[model samples]
Target: MTRSTRGGAPVAPKRVTPRAQWTRGSPGGTAGTPHPTASRRRWRRTVIARRAADHVCETFGADGIQGVCGHPEIEVALAEFARYTGDRKYLEQARLFIERRGHRTLADIEFGRQYFQDETPLRETDVMSGHAVRALYLAAGGVDVAVETGDDELLSALRTQMANTIGRRTYLTGGMGAHHEGESFGLDYELPPDRAYSETCAGVGSVMVNFRLLLATGESRYADAIERTLYNVVAGSPGEEGTSFFYTNTLHQRVPGSTPSPDEQSPRAASSLRAPWFDVSCCPTNVARTFASLGAYVATSSADGLQLHQFVSGEVKAELAAGHVSVAIETRYPDEGTVRVTVAETVADEWELAIRVPGWARSGGLLVVGDSEPETVAPGMARVRRRFAVGDVVELRLDPAPRFTYPDPRVDAVQGSVAVEAGPLVLCVESVDLPDGAGVNELRVDPAVAPRVADGRTVVTGRMARFEPTDWPYDPEAEDVDETAAFEFALTPYHRRANRGPATMRVWMPCA
Candidate 1:
């Protein structure tokens, strides 16, 4: 299972060790020479990681290292090295790993036969299940193998599984992993806001899978998923401008707990209050890496031109089939719906610029090319092909109206309640913003009223019906309890909750 390098040391390929070197220098490095010190440092880490991987492979054989589906982890590493170095041997090893999966090699594990996704083979599996992170990482490896081997059937199967994951298993924040038991995916429409185990690591893994999918299909939907998760779950992971961290993200927290000390571990599965660090602290490191490489996700190049997926204010320069195009994007996106893209430099006379229209942009969207007439753009993406000049601007306006969303009826947890969302942010009602003695659970939203920005925070002014509870369950036959005067309350984004202090928060509210 282990590969021998120079001196018979079992390690990952030497080209894989160049990862840190590539990261330190330009990713567009020449294949001939690599920087000396960075290469050494990266090789050290690669050996350490490969030794661990080798130990697992030797222990588990075809069952894989971490689990039955874990062979893809090593396969991805080898495939990446192969792509960078053009080594066919590494590709062969990667192909071997792919072929060995889906035989239930680790079925005897206490969790069950399907626990490690060994129940079904990659090409035959239609629905994404098992640990959310593992499933995503495996799919990414599958994408690499499919692209390298020119396996059209495997590529199509991976796309179908990606669609199934995005359409049915994803959260409003683009977070995955609904069950805390195994940090795994649950049944379709089984999403529960309160009991969500949307691990931060899983969210990062989702972005990785989506990025690979984007490269494979040249589609904008994958970028959409990346953008959503980046803004909501991943952005929410770092607390107070990247000081603390949240390992798990939940849309709602109905009860408040005492804030734990910086040295203390959180008693709850997911903390309402962000901690400075945790014992198992992969999230903080993952968030750091994602932020460092964010520019890579904002724009992608094609034979025609460049496509912009995220609207963050940044500079995008990409070489296209026509020539190189550089554009400056200015926008207060997520907070505001306006994006202005100005062409700073251009080598191509005529090319295409594609901007993604978020699925939640209910009022559709508007795109204006230069001084031309404004044209409405539907969801998916808006493509503008034109001859460009320096200083020419493209304006896109997306609807920012606050909208209330309801879950599928099958998700019994929030069946009779509604959640509010403005742009990509999911809104929650926190006790700190409410009157004393009034908890978030006692509040209700008036769907007729629109939410507006108040004091730099999104606020929905709604009435809460007051009912006096006397027993465990009110008898239908008995007289109804007297109602007190209705009071008004406000709602804020779920990510902003507990920032001021530990407080109860609720995303789903009853209709008054």
Candidate 2:
């Protein structure tokens, strides 16, 4: 499906063309316009995005072409444009595009209608399929439309779809899209680590949905997903100082390939190392957009209180029902789970302050507000509701002990494998970190001993086993193994892998 874009040979709205991401620099729910002192470029967002959305509405809107675009981004952008321009027509256009999806109204692809989520209606679909990024963008758009139109039914369906997708179709590192064939989601539990396409744009799309859902439901699970994806997938894609980038983030690298040149455009799907650029440079732009708008994802404000989602060090100010308040957050977050939040300015009336305890910290967490005694908190929102003065403080300490994680039995690809995690970071053993003669594919780890963080490195017990070579590899009796050697190797965070040099790395280690 294609729409006439302000008068051109009708163009399909997808990432193929380098369209301006007007929704960047702000999350959702910005009403009216930017401040009067906002820059010319900032003010231009209202004109440029609104005009593009207006063209879309006039062409494919309800009273116009009764068709939808192949890609889903326009709908979500329209919702934001409606907010920026204070125009309800753009909101209606968004609602129309969302309701028109999943009806097989568009031409099918070689990968099938599910590739674009055209197999079922938006309100009836219960699971996410098709291209991982497209499905996520559609869900985000649906949630935005539902929020604006107060469509509870659509919101409920989207919630179910996201829960289903996160529970089954997602990777340990919070990545989606298992197949490189179409950058689409595989069947449930079909995640193969080495072959994962885990496109960087998909991670960005996941954060988009997660942030909206976080605000809509006030759920900690959404924030937890955001943390995992940001640490592992989004932050992992780019190299030092953002000079190079990985288009696809695979969980396991089976072979040590050649290093990428500083000037070359990488093969998008199979870049062995981070390349300087790519022809389809959507991942870089998506990453840049997310980074520029990070403050919105970090926290949100309400009429009565303020909530901190990600523990990044920052400051927040919001206008409450009683009066205005400002808070400053200081933290060393995932590295050391301690966060100190101070009320810089406050209203005399009572109000609430909330900080999130990530779902992964299932063991222990400590919270202290003002002069109160230390209180224990679990995996949810920890709140402090009381009269506040300047310099009032609230503190949170979370458990970040190194732990071993096992996959669900239904996931055959990694049924007997074990992985290590500390806080939100997934740890993997790289070939470069192994002892002599030990290969990533040839070693087996023992999970009986817990992982320990020493000198900022996660060390685990493992052994290298050598098998005798034979002309006919397969045999009925498999007893040609040589003596094995036991040793320990330091596990590096998955994001830091491939940065040292060309090396093979695997997140899922087979247990001995």
Candidate 3:
């Protein structure tokens, strides 16, 4: 698994490597010219972020007292913007609002409570207050900033609140957030199959807040929750097209033609397509902020070494006490688990590189590659402690095979259905890839048959399935029968679903 940098012979570190050389101008000074358009786009993104922050601050009261405005959603937006942009002004505004307008000493905002709509205060004993804590964590720049600023009071307060929330709310299935309306959390241990909220945005937000806390405290629990959320909840939120977004991500889907009204007060059924952006509009912008600030969440450094949290194709430059060390991480992740890390311009010193071998990957018997024979990093995490090297390269590989996953038995909608996944992407059967209206509720797949990639799509041919008409004979027991029909169907990555056309799509399909 190990590949030598140069012909198996240990090569001496050069003052300038290929990457450094490429970064610098060539002899003619014509190379390494910066792209004006690229630079402008980056600047424009910053501008837009700043403007958004300003708008949020201006629209909401700056003093933090209950304003004429109803809820703290605007403040949440402002605080999140501050987290990414590193704007002190926005942070201060967020702080003032939370400290002043927020509920008394120990209480925070409750989901769907009067405070959320009418600005009425509520008790925050141990509610699954992920949303409010998320806003507070973002406004305060996470746990790291709190520690650095020596605000032990605020840090302890937040940690206590979050710990209580996490300890009380998490389901046996590891799901959090329990209310479908306003996507809020319910009272202690109140998760039910048909009532579980577990909104995709809430999962993303909870993970984000936990990530910041992990970075600050170097705790592993936060990272564990993050992986769970990423693999199960967040990955299921997007449609195949990567455009339409799910407001709620259920483990199951409601039968076709049984769609519920917006105010029906029921958990949404899982589907392959995203609903239109909600009036709350938290998930879309939440996705944008997560992607935009992803770099900050990848790795961390101290006097000792670096910790690689997430694996992707990117380079991280850290400033160590000895000098500057740039680590380039090249990997085909979530697709193929091979990851390579090349160290450059690093002084000879003992350092540690920690890699997260996802829980699923470990169970599948993946291997990590170093200079010697491959090593098995346990699922969840693996760490390598080694001495100095300027050009040392490390590679790790995980299992990357397509598999089908069934919903937790408690989730009613997907009881007999299953989802297809490869690497990190969840796949779905799209109606556009099927034959006209025949693709509607009639989609069914044989569990024993494997789907193959053809014409840039994953397709399956199996026994036919039937969808009851919009208005048909109502018989719950009859709908579960496996009719001896057959049809060929194709699926796409969930993130790329809606891009093709208006078509019914289903992530969970009946398994024969």
What lDDT does each candidate get?
0.72, 0.82, 0.55
Model 3 scores a TM of 0.63
Ranked candidates, highest TM-score first = 2, 1, 3
Clashes of 3: 16
Q: On residues 110-134, what C-alpha lDDT tens digit does candidate 2 reach at each position?
A: 9998888788888998889998999
Cα TM-score per model: 0.85, 0.91, 0.63
Candidate 3 wrong stretches, greater than 4 Å: 1-180, 183-204, 219-289, 362-369, 435-437, 448-462, 467-482, 485-488
* True-vs-predicted CA distance for residue 172, candidate 2, Å: 0.5
Name the candidate, 1 or 2, with the larger lDDT value: 2
The model with the greatest TM-score is 2
Supply every candidate's count of residue pairs whose N, Cα or C atoms clash at under 3 angstroms: 0, 0, 16
For residues 417-499, could you state the per-residue lDDT of candidate 3 as single tens digits? 77777655667775556565455355567887776666655667656655445455776655676565565577666555455
* Residue pairs of candidate 1 with colliding backbone atoms: none
Model 2, residue pairs in steric clash: none
Indicate the residue-level lDDT of 147 in model 1.
Answer: 83
Off by over 4 Å in 1: 1-32, 35-72, 267-270, 465-471, 477-488
Worst-scoring 10-residue span by lDDT in model 1? 9-18
Q: Which ten residues in a row have the lowest lDDT in candidate 2?
A: 10-19
CA displacement after TM-score superposition, residue 177 of candidate 2 (Å):
0.6
